[model samples]
Target chain A: MLVVNTEFVPGFEVTKVLGLVQGNTIRAKHVGRDIAAGLKNLVGGELKGYTELLTEARRQAIERMISQAEQLGADAVVNVRFTTSAVTAGAAELYAYGTAVTLAGGA
Target chain B: MDGDAATFNFLILLVPIVLIVLGAGVGGLTARTHLRSLERREAELTSIEVNNLKFVRDPGSAADTRMVLGQVVIATDYFKSLATALRNLVGGEMRAAEGLMNRARREALVRMLEDARSMNADEVWNVRFGFSNISQMRGKQGAMQVEVFAWGTAVRRGASA
Candidate 1:
């Protein structure tokens, strides 16, 4: 249930490394938001709409990764990393990956 | 009727040019303001401790570590984006785009520092960063949006050293 981006958790010994666990999600652009972003691009401040869209995508990807780690009976997930790609013109794909491991002590 | 049509055609041609000029002016002002704010924030964060070391070399320090993450996404305006489009064509360095990216990374780093400060963390270690593109569309020409993310482990000293 715990997640850290470091390879080793402080004060906890990794007894078993389950394997790599990952999750990914692809989201397409919304027509309304796309129009809003286009207008924002003209004057260009932060496009709050697009920012929120990517934030939501990242959160969902992390949630899915956590579920997979839980299924593996892992005490913690470590060395987590996120990557993103523009697979198509109007779609974005986000991937979250990490190593699942069990600590010597129960969480 | 001829005069009316003539004015209509002239108006149609004038509007897009006007919009681009106005967009440049507004976007310039916004960028200036953001730069001032970022400079002020960076000054404020000067007191916070930061490190990119692999681990705490001084052992027996007994520090509690927790992961901290910060992310910021920024969009380009009409003027700089035009410059970027040109850079793409000629295959040369894009200084304008570089400035925009620098701003995004600084914003993300400041947010991470704020998170560490909230937890009374004296120093951060194992810092990392990521950059990604998002909010793409088919019809839009020369539109670029990027997100910068920062991550580190914040450590609070437990007085065990």
Candidate 2:
């Protein structure tokens, strides 16, 4: 899965454009990490706790995206991009999207 | 005379200076941490806006290939509300949540676009986004699930998207 903000993937030429593919997951790590961080602020340095929180969130979201691509029967996903949102106060949403393309021609 | 001078310095100078430095450090750290939290929240909001399914025309196809993306969120408003309420209590950043939603929506769109192409369409045109709330009620509590969906028509492009 090659993800990018741009509409087209740079290195490779897209030969076939498959239909839509997507994946998503809702998470609660933000609230927990924030609470932990609030306490850690008393004695501060690098925020290791929040870092872990974010890493885990990213993993889950990516997994969901792959699952969606599988469902759509895409050979590969190109021009992928990531986006995040706070749907509610504590919970967060992570999404990855791109074009599912079959590559044959070399760019 | 030396002993007296040392004692005087400790009593009059070192104590106040130490106290002031400690106070400043604590205040500064608190402010920095609070600012970070706020920024994280703002980022999350921005990601949500970014995640919105925006259809784009495929440049490669000579035929018009228009694609629209949407998603099945698979999370409930109630769950979001509760999570948010908890965050308010603990003072957590909401940006992660927003990012997640945006990601989901985009993925949905991507899949739809791929599906269109598989049909050997030159391009998808007049792509549109549509959503359905698939929340079901449990015995006591309402279920938590929302599907973010993106749909569009695939057509061979002779004209520009």
Candidate 3:
């Protein structure tokens, strides 16, 4: 399925609005990564471990959102948006949402 | 016992002072270096058009379009965290924290542009950013960190609509 953050795809017209589909996941950093992060904080730089964790979490969230769209018979997802929240000190929640729609000619 | 207590107190004061000094020296260098690198890369990638507009005015025969994402997590050094803590009491703008967040955002966007470049895309549209604080807390010691996620649709110009 096609996914774009814009309201409409460049060359295609949206035929049906399948309402809103969303997915979210909460992930916690492991102890090993946290210790490494604490040390990295001293000098200040990119936390590769945390970055990868977030990327993985975001991918999972998007995957779930896409699966939901597929279930709705959507050819594409439009106007996609992502949000994140710190559920606690060590865990964060990533949420992806979009309007699922069917294109005129379909995907 | 009295002499030992005095030395213990002296050591306690010296530890944080040393930490702040290290943080200032190293962390400052890291931020400056990253900023300079970002500037250089941004200048180099000036050819790629990037914008938040939902639609491109002239796609010029869109060849292909796909979603691209870039993310980064940056942590603040002890010095900045100390500055923030002090600024909290004054109830003023925390410039140190602001700089940290700015660096993270720029880094994420730059990475996204690089991703588009790799795909041989000319422009990126509908760009959006997401941010979060992923600092782990440990009692009174919590490292300050910010995560920036940038995403957009990369369009490759071709002979097709």
lDDT of each candidate versus the true structure? 0.79, 0.47, 0.86
* lDDT-based ranking: 3, 1, 2
Best candidate (score: TM-score): 3
**Model 1, span B26-63: residue lDDT tens:** 97888889899989988987876777765643423536
Give me the candidate number with maximum DockQ.
Answer: 3
Order of the predicted models by DockQ, top scorer first: 3, 1, 2
Better of 1 and 3 by lDDT: 3
How high is each candidate's TM-score?
Answer: 0.87, 0.39, 0.91
lDDT of 3 by residue, A7-97 (tens): 8876677889999999999998888998998888888889999899889999999999999999999988888899998777677889999
**B11-93 per-residue lDDT for model 3 (tens digits):** 99999999999999999999999999999999988899999998865644666677888899999998888888888889988
Q: lDDT by residue for model 2 over A1-107, one digit each (tens)?
A: 44333344433466778866666666664456555544333333324554344446655666677677677666566545556566655555666666676655422
Q: By DockQ thresholds, what CAPRI class is model 2?
A: incorrect
Q: Choose 1 or 3, whichever is better by TM-score.
A: 3
Which regions of candidate 1 are displaced past 4 Å?
A105-107, B56-63, B87-91, B135-139
Once fitted onto the true fold, the runs of candidate 3 whose alpha carbons sit more than 4 angstroms away are A105-107, B1-6, B136-142
DockQ of each: 0.48, 0.07, 0.56
**Predicted candidate 2 versus true structure: per-residue lDDT over B53-94, tens digit per residue:** 233344443342323343433332333434444666799696
